[model samples]
Structure formats: C-alpha cells, structure tokens
Target: MKNLFIPHFIYWSLFMTSKENYHKVSILLSIYKVEDYLEECLDSLLNQSYHNLEIVCVDNGSPDNCGKILQKYAKKDSRIKIVTLKENRMLCGGRNAGLDHATGDFVCFVDPDDWVEKDHIKAMVDAILTKKDSLGNPYNLVLNRNAVSFMILADGSLKKMYDFGETSGEKTLNDVNLNVREDTEVPMWGRLYRKSFLDAHPDIRFLEGMNTDNIPYTFKLLAHMKRFYVIKGEENATYWRRLITPEGAITPVVLWKNMEIPICFDNLFDYLKKHHLAKNLRIPYHWFFTICFPRHKDQPRYYLRFKELMKKMEDTVKSSDVYKQEDRNLCDLLLYAPDFFNFMERYFTPVPVRISRSRIKLFGFIPFWYIRHKERKVYYDLFKIPLFKRVKTDDKEILYLFHFLPIWTRQTDRQ
Candidate 1:
C-alpha cells in the first residue's frame, strides 16, 4: 500500500534526466570596487534557475572587501570561477579577463555592482538556445530588451526603480528610439551571447578606456549578427544597476566631464570604413548621436560640444558611400544649426529636474518640477537622473541557494 517502488523510480528518473540535458552557460562579471553590492550580485548568479552555470568573476583588483567576498562565494559554490588582479583595469579590461576564462557554449556579462531578476539567466538562455534540439539560432544574439536601474541612497537603502518607463520586445537597430533609450539603459548587459558568434567575431570586444565602448560593441552586433530573439514580459531578463553607490558614477554633460560621444563616433567611422560597411550605415549611424540633441542642447557647454559633434558627424556623412545630396544637406543643417523651434526647447525643457532622494520616495509617480538657475540661460542638465519605474514582481524557478535582499526577490522599499 506504500508504493515506495514508484517514488524511487521517479526520483532516479529525474536525476538521470537532468544529467543528460546539461547546457552550460558562462557568466562573465567584471568587478572593480563593488564591496557593498558584491554579495547580492554573486547570490543572483550562483542561484540562477539554470543550475549548469560557470560564473567567471574577475575582481579588477578592487581595494575593498570585494575580492574577499568573491573568494567566499567561490569556496561555497564550485560553479563559481574567480580571477583576482592586482591592479584595477577599469571595466573593459576586467571583462576581458573574465572572457578569457569563459568555457561555456553561451556567455553573459554582469557588472558586480548590479543584480538581476530571478529568472533572468533562465529566460535569457532559453531565448538564446530557442528549442534546444537546434541549439537556438546559433548566430544572432538574444536580448531582454529592457533593464532597470536602482539608486542606492547614501544610507545603503534603495529608493525603488528609477522610473524610466518600460517597453517590451527587441529595440531593433531600425527603431527610432534605439540610440536614445538604449544608451540610457545598460545597453551592453541584460543579453546572452552565443559563444560561436563571439568566437567568430572575437574582435567585437569592449573598447578599453573608451567612454562609449558600447557603441562599437552594439554596432558590431547590429551589423554582423544574423538576427535578434528578444525576450520580454513574464520571461523578464534584466539587471538592476545600483547607481549612486558608495563611489558613485560619473555625471554626463552640462559641464561635459566626459563628452566622448564624438570621439567615439570618429572611431566608429574609422572602423566602418576599414571594414567597408560605411556606405550602408551612414544615416542610421549619424542618427545615433542626433537623437539626443534636443535633450542635450540645454546644457552649460552645449554649444561647445554640439559644434564639434556636428563637425565630426558631417565628415563621416560626407565620406559615406551613398547618400542623397538633399539628405546630406539636411543632415548638415540639423547638425550645424538648430531651427528656432528646436532651439527654444532650452526654455521649455523643464530645467532638467534633479529629483532628490526625498522627492523620489515621496512621490508615487514621476514628477516634473521646473527649476530656476542663477545663470542667464536658466537650463537644467538632461542626463542628471535616469528614467525608470517602480513595479512589483515575483520570483521564478526559485533555485535560491542563497537568499539575499537586493538579489532578484527583494521588493523595492520606495515609500
């Protein structure tokens, strides 16, 4: 009456079956000085729904407790691969080191300071491998198409997601908002890469020391990759970039701390030219920078940078293989001179609202408050804060070997 034999057979069957279908994934995480958030990041990776993961975490020689925490996790989970460097190689080099250690069929990048959704890897690997029998599309890359950013206040508590709004499905190269939104979002991470494709296109690595490294990586994927399989909705594949952490992040614009867009574009032009792809990507490539013009035109040194930006873009467009003369002229005008209607956007752009920590936690929705500056122009910097939203989500395929707040399941603590 106990029926012990049936249960024994089922247990053995599952054990044997799971062993038979192990598709390994290599997670490449680049670490610098992420001591505060390192534990959360590792927990998410080590406890993914997919058990067959080889996490290659490279500590770019962080001076804090980051390396120690990583070593602790590595000891606990044999799946974790740790690489320690004596000197910080910034983000790109650190990732390269991890890439060198990757041995999985598919590869993914995760910043050590960030956390992902519970089903993030499971969903991404599913999208990349597609139906399994065929090993997915094998050629094109797969993306979650959306990512979330969380600002860790000075006190180490989060104020929820940064209300950038959300759009589902693939943000294709052809989409008009691709440049604008993708740049704001962590465009590089949140996607799974097929090892075969990356191996073949090995040169498509992140540009070391380049501020706009994503441009080259993204452009290469756009030009060379076969197609995209975008994962969205219930199968959410996204990362939470912990902005305003202990060390904080560099602000973009107004004073132009690192306005390297044009410099990066120059490199792009040269790369496309060397590879003979310049002719075809002229307009689309040019649109990459101009899409953010209206938003950036109100900054302190807007005109200073905007002038150089136009000059560089114009050069690339002129040298491009094919383009209508009229189109080129229009491109020059938009690049060289903004019309009155567009120029006046400086006044009406709501002075680049910088919602303080209190403002964000207090308000349930995104607020628009105009500010008055002492300067004559009275303009606000557009890139001050990220546009993100607060949403409630549940955990998936809970393989949570380690339960940690800020690791996929923790709900936003926004007031």
Candidate 2:
C-alpha cells in the first residue's frame, strides 16, 4: 500500500503544476575567454531567487580556464548545462548553439563576462506572467534596464558608473515604433523572450560569420513583435555590463567590416519585403538613413560597391510611404551632395534647426504669452530675429519687444 501511494502522489503533484502557472526560464550564456569573470557570472545565476531555471552555457573553444570552471559549477548545480564546441565560432555561432540546446518555457541571454542581480530571472518571469496586451495576449518580449560597469584597478573589480533610463514603470508597447525611435536600446541582454514564440519563428536566429551580428537579428524581432512589456526598477534586476577588461579593449574600426552595416540593413529590408510586411520598412530604414548612410563616405570603396548600395537604399526610401518630407530631403543631400561637404556638414553639424524649436506651455497647456523665432547658424547671430510674436495676457507689463526693439515686457509669477 505504501508503494501504491507513492506512485499516486507523484502523479498528483505533476498534474497540479501547469506550464502556465510555473514557467521555466532558460538563461543562455556563451562562454568564451572569460575565465577571470566566469565564476562571478555563474554564481549570480545559481543564486537567483528563481528556482526553475536552466542555465545553458556554450563552451565555444575558450583557450582560458572557462571550460574547467563551467564543469566545476555543473557538478555543484545540475541546473548549469554545458555544450562544447570544437573551435571558436564567434558570438553568433556560440549563442546559436546555446539557443539550440535550451529547453525552457521562456528564454533569455547573458554574457559570461557580465553578471546579473540575484532577482533578474524572477523579476522578468513575474512581469511576463502578469502582463498582457490590449487583446489579452501574453507579451512575447520583456525589456529591463541595465548598468554600464567599468573595471577599476584599485581592487581589480567592476564598478557601476552609469545607468540607462526609460525603465521607470511597467508598460505595454508597440515594438516597431520603439525600434524606430533613436533613443531605444537594442542589445539582447536585459530582456526576456517566450520560448514558444521563438520556436515558431525559427529563421530569427542570429546571422553567423559577422561582427556586430545583433543588428539584423534584433531588428527582425522588433519588427515581428505584436507587443512587448517593459518593467523598470523591479527587484534591482539590472544586468551589469562590463565595458573595459584587461585584454578585451575596444577594437579599431575596419572598413570592410563597416561595409557589413548596409548588408545588415538590406538583410532586414529583404526579410520584411518577402513577408509582405514591407510597411515595417520604417524601422530599419530610419537607422540606415540617419545613422548608417552618413558614415558610408568614409569607406574607401564609396564610389565602387558602396555607392551603388546607397543608391539602392535611397530608391527604397523614396518609394516607401512611411517617411515624411523632411526625411526625403535629408536622403537627397546624402546622395546628391558633394562627398566632402556631405561628410563634413552632415557629420559635424550641431543639432539641426528642426530639433531645437522651443515653446512655452502653462501647466502643460497653451501659454498666454508666445514668442516665435527663426532658425540660423551661430555664425549669423547678428541677423537672427524673431519670425513672429504674439502676446495675450492681462498681467501688468514691465517690458516688451516689438519686432527687434523692446517696447514692454512683463514679469509674472506663472512665468
């Protein structure tokens, strides 16, 4: 009777716990030459408040002691699973290997050189489970804030010197608009993804054999997402990203590799076109035009292959209905302006006039007093004057400006 009861109890426990109630989050880490920091990274995940986690680490032929360290952790905690590769396959290849091995209800990424707060996994899991879109669908992605850390030689430790913003509260968002906005952060870390959603779109894997491979991969995810959730300042689940290391200093720019920027853009463009989601071109095209296209002239082959690619991009932007008239004019200067002027003027120019417009609002509404000014370069300060002016206030006046001369104006408490 005791033996029969044991089997029945095990079956009952399994039936009681449903996948929806308890989600298994797989934290994927690609192990490379991070032996010095590997232990701290592993410990952070192992100590996470969230218990149901699969820590998948891909040993991408690290010449350092990372492999041995991983083995040591795996023995202590069965949650740490390791996948060994014969040779170094770069970041894309290593992450792809981990993604293939991960078996969890939700998926996330972490850099072996970086570490997360103890509640990182738990915070993300709670937000994703409780939050739903307008249509009552679960969020496919969730983004959080992270801290940028720098190494300090005084104690040979990482110090958090900077914090990223835009994560104040929980909110539902449209991902395409977020991607198009210049302020949005695109790094894969500090985010959570639904495993089933990723499995449904198998082609969204990172493109291998390229530097800075996340551009195309992330753009694809943003374009396809129906809606995503963002939870800020929750349980201090910040991803601490180490910017400087002893041996891993930043690399110098390579012209040939820079050429891949357009290739990445085109890859995203073609994907959207093939799927009949060409309307989403605004996401990639915005970055290509504003950020990537301006730097193309620096390439030595600007006249050869790069020029042709720019023309193709210009045509695509011209044909798209997503851009406003201002964007089209900027593209015109990019393609038609002389190379030297375009390079210096576009790159070195301060904030354009359009972005510097100022307005006075009263309690976040229209103000009683108004002043209109014209735009001009700093060199032409003498010629600068108000384009128009309007005043509609009952307050006592102290002084005011009529055209270029001051006639009367007022000092008010509200002002």
TM-score per candidate: 0.65, 0.72
Clash statistics: count for each candidate = 8, 5
- Which stretch of 10 consecutive residues in model 2 shows the poorest summed lDDT? 374-383
lDDT of 2: 0.67
lDDT of 2 by residue, 47-125 (tens): 8888788999999889989999999999999999999998988777888998999899999998887778787777888
Q: Give me candidate 1's TM-score against the actual structure.
A: 0.65
Cα distance off (Å), candidate 2, residue 252: 7.3
Question: Model 2: residues >4 Å from true position, as ranges?
Answer: 1-22, 146-159, 168-186, 234-236, 246-257, 284-309, 319-330, 338-415
